[model samples]
Target: MNPGLYVFDFRFTEYFQMTIKPLLEEGKDGELIDWLKDISLLRRGQKCTNPDCQGTKPMEWKRARIVDKFHWSCPLCKKKVSIRTDSPLAEFHCSFKIILETIVAWCDGISLEEYTKENKNVKGVIAKRIYSTCTAATDWYMQTHPELTLLGGENSVVLVDTYPDGCMTTTPHNNNYTKRVLCVADTSHMPARIWAQLIDNKILDYQKLAAVVVGHIRPGSTVVASPSLYPLLHGVKGMAEVISVEALMALDPVDYQRSLKNLETIWRTTVSVCQDIQNTSNAEGEQMLRELEWRQVFPTPLSQILHDLAAHATAISS
Candidate 1:
């Protein structure tokens, strides 16, 4: 238990890259299971969580009916909690292998229904598991990484825009819902960044964009925006540039088409996937978004990415 480590160790990424990735790549999920279990159980010397007996006894890790987990029985409290008590995997009451494979499959953009079909499990189980675990983990992650709480705070060239959310059907004339996003990029960073929110109105007016820009972007950064939002870019603390379709019509078509090509491609894909669920709810839309964000930022295996995002993002105990 590295209780001494309060702030996250930067080496965590390197550890995942060097250690875990090698094991998984070699198709050694068995050994990977052992390593995951060891890491989760010994994450830190967790104290007995019982109020009356918060003692420092070495808990006995009992093998349960579950495939790859331990019931850590506290000596002082004589109580049992999962070794996953303080980890992102805790929300999943299933085994580590199921959790790990689920992460890998979901990161590959397999929907809950598809995953359940492939695994031949009941739909409700997988849906509930993914929803509870991923959502809880994501919530914990955002709360912990306050630096990344709101996007565009770092020195970045933010491209501000809106697109149809596609959570519902859209008629040709009137869009149903919209998603406003700040696409932040540093030529230095390999992968550009994005932060998004569902807005009730399709239009992102000056007042709306201005209210968001002040809270999100860092002071004195450059901002390239869509024509509709071009007027509001000045309301932000950045050097603003416009990239409206009308303005693009006057410029070289190639450059104009290329500006937001990457984000547009992803947004289109998200819209398609999100609209598939029968009676899609707000939770499902956000779940898809969370998965998209996680896949974008972390290139490691699903298990490692989930852990890194959830565990080190905040301190936890059970």
Candidate 2:
């Protein structure tokens, strides 16, 4: 029987922890498949995609002589398709449970090698494919969301800082390394919106740097940045005010102390995220930053996160 698609429910966080986790721990593959189907992660009464089929009918889920264990059959044309035909698991040939656990591992920031070591059922090659697919879906999710581009609003506190990322630095002797990254943290709400751009060691264009910073921030907003950035951002259009960290510290010691703490946290977090990738190109570094930005902006529950990713993949595949 087909179950209704799950809505964005935070309660599922508890449900997953209480029920699904135990089921997985017990190695109940059949129960896990049932739960996956219940959450719409696996196809149940999905429509047949065969263009040559005679009628538009709901595909039936039945046992199949394959590794996936189940296939969707078109009752009209007898066309059998894998249960993962159109979901995020479309290209993954692994079992449903393995793919689901791989997704969970990816979302939890678990390393691919660590995941394969823990789950003996998944091979190195298969885990890599799953991880790659998850990465692509994440990129698509972040790229499609237009609201993630610009951050902060009028009368909001925006913290801007620079961090030197080692991962983005390819070569130091050749002078082709990424020098530092300018990061903006919008503290208007919880789980602040973060945006960053890598600065090349060779190019120290202040005008270009100022322009990039201005593009990410909205007008009538207070910008808290380093003293060096003051001249570059001074008298720029639409900014409510620009204050140097030193001057602000002198003006209001309490607020300035709090801002210092926030700045330190932001830098620490950025460094930690960048260090996760080892010796990457500028393009890959930027992509990682963008993904980081996306995560910071929307820190939803894992269940909803996976569902949204699956929906995006299904749309593209269809």
Candidate 3:
């Protein structure tokens, strides 16, 4: 049996022990995978590049290459391939084991030094590779996952805010510090969709922010945000209405927190499980990987926690 494939079997055991069992005991496992799978993050395999073929089967795992990544092949076309063929992992020199480890570390928020030490690789190389992979993944996730982008419809509301990051600062002028991001959080989905930027901290710059937001969110979607953001968002098209975050703060804090907490918990569970499945690169593991990717677009435990934090903050002022 392939070692990479074994990783997923181990992961299944771990997931069942840690998450599935408890959910079953609670009588919730009936739809646990369905619920979790809806939001789990995994990769989607594409069809054979051969256009003439009527079949639309995804590439399948064949064996591990000498370097240790799982190889794939299209049965219909007789084309042999590897997991990295169409992903950010493509053309990577590291083994599948190391790539999986690096992905887990990233999801778990491990430091660069820790990842380097654990893998016995140079810190700079590890950082650069992980960064490239993540940035690529982020871009791919945003594009391929329509749920993450669509924000317009009945009862849909878009939330906007900014978070401070030390790494974002470069040269400074007026404030000597750069508030390099403006973000839009769409509450249209249970987990919410987020778009971020590295930009100057000018309020007017929100026009660009609005453009990004409006493009994803349908025109006539309700928009909500802090008072400080209203002026910046004026005259943007596609908004049916704009509400102050203060209005949201008016809701019952306890209720808001409870709902937010549950949402985050589910999101966290989904992300954790998905990352674990991706770390395993074998034939058996491939199925789980596909399932996990299918669910990745849905909200997970971690996202719920973040959303709760945002919702609670908004509620406090209401």
Candidate 4:
């Protein structure tokens, strides 16, 4: 009897420093700042962002002190930039420690409100950002990825569908209505190959669906869609379409059954994950999309998610 890989894992920090550190070590601002730098997210200097230094300053790093907490000195221009000059969290005003703590809370999967109670030094918005920027980041990921420029390939299959994302609770000021979002995922690739647009409880027609998906799909792959989508995609060129169960039935029965089975598995997982989302905010749809990507890469409870977050947040030199 051997345990699986996750069973004996010790790769993640089991205790949050802010929550459990006082009992084990000194809790002070200086220590916290050192910890932030140790994670590799914050640095003492960075490449100058000055507009005038065009390509000439290939590797010129500026050194400047940030709010007296960190130093960033520019060697070429002799001007100082913020330590967080080029990372994702660069624009935010919160301290580096708060950002790390907020991210940890999010990975732990407790509501943002609860995390605040444990750490008085953090703000609600910071914790909320763990949930907030995901959608934007996801959109950013799609726009930046080369494969997403054209979504389809030799053996690609795309599954498109929309389902209710549950209704908001009744409040005196709010009406109860079920919200929906568009899910067009390329099942050909394992996890990162998906895009979502939140419709705020509204549904899209077939023509609109085809238009949106066609751009993301590649030039020469077969797309399998529902009967309702057939009319929308009939004459679309540079791609092949398999529309409806009837169309699938026309194929070899053995292959058709296998296809149906795979389709059900993928669709069910997507829906089930979306449904697990507790917050119905329009932003959460995108966050869920991003979380899906993270889960695929890390593949565990939120702690593993935190490991990746810490790595990405701290490892940038810029």
Candidate 5:
């Protein structure tokens, strides 16, 4: 089946339930692998790496009952290469079902335990590796997509806040704290936009926080933040005009409520993500937040995400 026919806004779970699960139930694994190749998740049209072939011939995919499940075969030279030989999936030694299911779980924000509960065949370590690959894809998206990375412009208003979090330390008795500075760009029409960073320093000085925020926000937009941030952000070079949350609340209640509404959503969602965060070290917390930020920024369906990963496969590696 052509993947284009499945281009709808259904959630990943729904798609998996309706499409992928049936394929597995019917034992049509090869067709599923073909679909993955169709979406570019598995490597496609790759040239054989055998020295005898001299990269002159395209490799054909051959399905087998091998550990990798698939390989790329050169007809002329009779050489074979693993389907994941040079792709981002090189290090992954799991089935495509596990890999795809892991992507769905990651996108749906399903915890590892929850995912394993539903799909008992998946081992925790393999699932974690897939989750890491998803994070790497998000990091690549943030680094390369400037339009999504930088928020706010001309008439936009960005709601700003800081979240206190604990970081992990190697010393068993020592602990460290960091601030997660979050900026939610509210355009009043478009879906909310977000930019987040974990400040390495413990100090939450206005100047330091403002400097970090200013870089992500565009000029001419207004920044609605707590009073402590006013002085540093109000008149900084190339920075947006700053307004205290209280003042914005009083002067323009509609916009104020709108910004607050978005901020509240972000806070509530992130707080839920960090609820059991005390058990996890700071590094893990940051990864969770980064994953959240990624979902907010892209908000694409599983197919689109797969296509994106395939398109930028070289940049995102295991």
Candidate 6:
């Protein structure tokens, strides 16, 4: 009878039945529903937090009035709640299905306009909400999961590299914005433990770059970066190793190219293996292989050995 809580549970149930269950078919429906029931609604029968008033012995579900698309009000407490109350989707005007779709699109790196069009919704609202949600989720994920934070404290080994990606066209100057991605990875080679920033310029300004890097990377952590970034390392005491590109390029050109090619091949193969592992529910094995593949791309001497090991392990595991 409590519309606020009822609507909340109903929405959750609808989402699971319509979206999640089909995707995770291996999971039991009853179990999932039970799990949902625990966090699904904010009911009035739930003991009122007010200590002084003990009017009702057994609290009842008091129907709440629905205001807008999501806003609602409880009759007893006059408390306001959204349809998404107590859930991450709370405060969102979009349906659960649209939110799920937007999340998927974001993970796949799809544009907001594309996602909005696909869901047949107002582009401005969808875009704004999706971007805000993504940024918040990213922040929350980094905070809750330390392993996902790429640049750990000073003791951490952070690797910084920049690669030229495609250009962006919508700049105020109508100039092509070169995409330089700055990534910080641990020595263990776990999936990028943090969000990578796409830098705007092609030139690597040491001071500016160092500020950004130092802000994220913990002090005293060994920062492995190219010589171009050495300027930024000034004044920053502690373990910061700048590897010279010339030194790496000094190797036989053919051999270097061969190594790069081999690395790319291994990386692609590893991604395929990961997909297969996920399909078979072998997440542990997939994680291991992903780590191995990452080590191969990282600038390290053991890269070749690790790549070989990953190939053998894949074969054996298969």
Best model number under TM-score: 2
Off by over 4 Å in 1: 1-34, 41-57, 62-93, 121-127, 149-157, 165-174, 177-188, 202-205, 234-237, 240-245, 253-263, 266-291, 301-304, 308-318
Model 5 error, position 154 (Å)? 3.2
Residue 191, model 4: lDDT of 53
Q: lDDT of each model, Cα atoms only?
A: 0.50, 0.67, 0.46, 0.52, 0.62, 0.42
Candidate closest to the true structure, highest lDDT: 2
- lDDT by residue for model 5 over 201-304, one digit each (tens)? 55656676777778777887777765555666777665457777667546546634654454555455444443434356677656655655666665555655
Model 3 Cα lDDT, one tens digit per residue, 1-318: 112211322223454357444543433523442333233321245466777543778777555544533455787887765544544345446643454445444444454565576666534585557644443343444444556445555577766544332111122324332333344555655544545443445455556766665676677778775556666565666588876654555663754544334333423322233334333444323333322332234322233322222333233335
TM-score of each: 0.63, 0.76, 0.45, 0.53, 0.73, 0.46
List runs of model 4 lying over 4 Å from the truth: 1-40, 43-126, 129-139, 143-149, 165-177, 199-205, 246-261, 272-318
Name the lDDT value of residue 7 in candidate 2. Answer: 20
Sort by TM-score, top down from the best: 2, 5, 1, 4, 6, 3
Higher-scoring candidate on lDDT, 1 or 2: 2
Q: Which ten residues in a row have the lowest lDDT in candidate 2?
A: 1-10
Tell me the tens digit of each residue's lDDT in model 6 across 1-318: 111110122223444457454633443533433332344322223343445434544333333444222334444665544434444444456544454445444433345555566666545676567545543433333344444443555446555544332111111221232234454445434433433454546565657777777676666566555455545664576555444333443564753454334323323323332223333333333233333233334322122222232233233335
**Candidate 3 ranges beyond 4 A from true positions:** 1-91, 119-131, 140-147, 163-177, 201-212, 232-240, 249-318
Q: Which stretches of candidate 6 lie over 4 Å from their true place?
A: 1-19, 22-87, 121-124, 143-158, 162-182, 194-224, 230-242, 255-318
Between candidates 3 and 4, the lDDT winner: 4
Query: lDDT by residue for model 2 over 219-273, one digit each (tens)?
Result: 8889887767777887788888887776666655663465455565555545555
Please provide, for model 1 over 17-68, each residue's C-alpha lDDT reduced to its tens digit, 9 standing for 90 to 100: 5765565554464566557656552244456777777655767666665544
As a TM-score, model 6 comes out at 0.46
Of candidates 6 and 1, the better by TM-score: 1
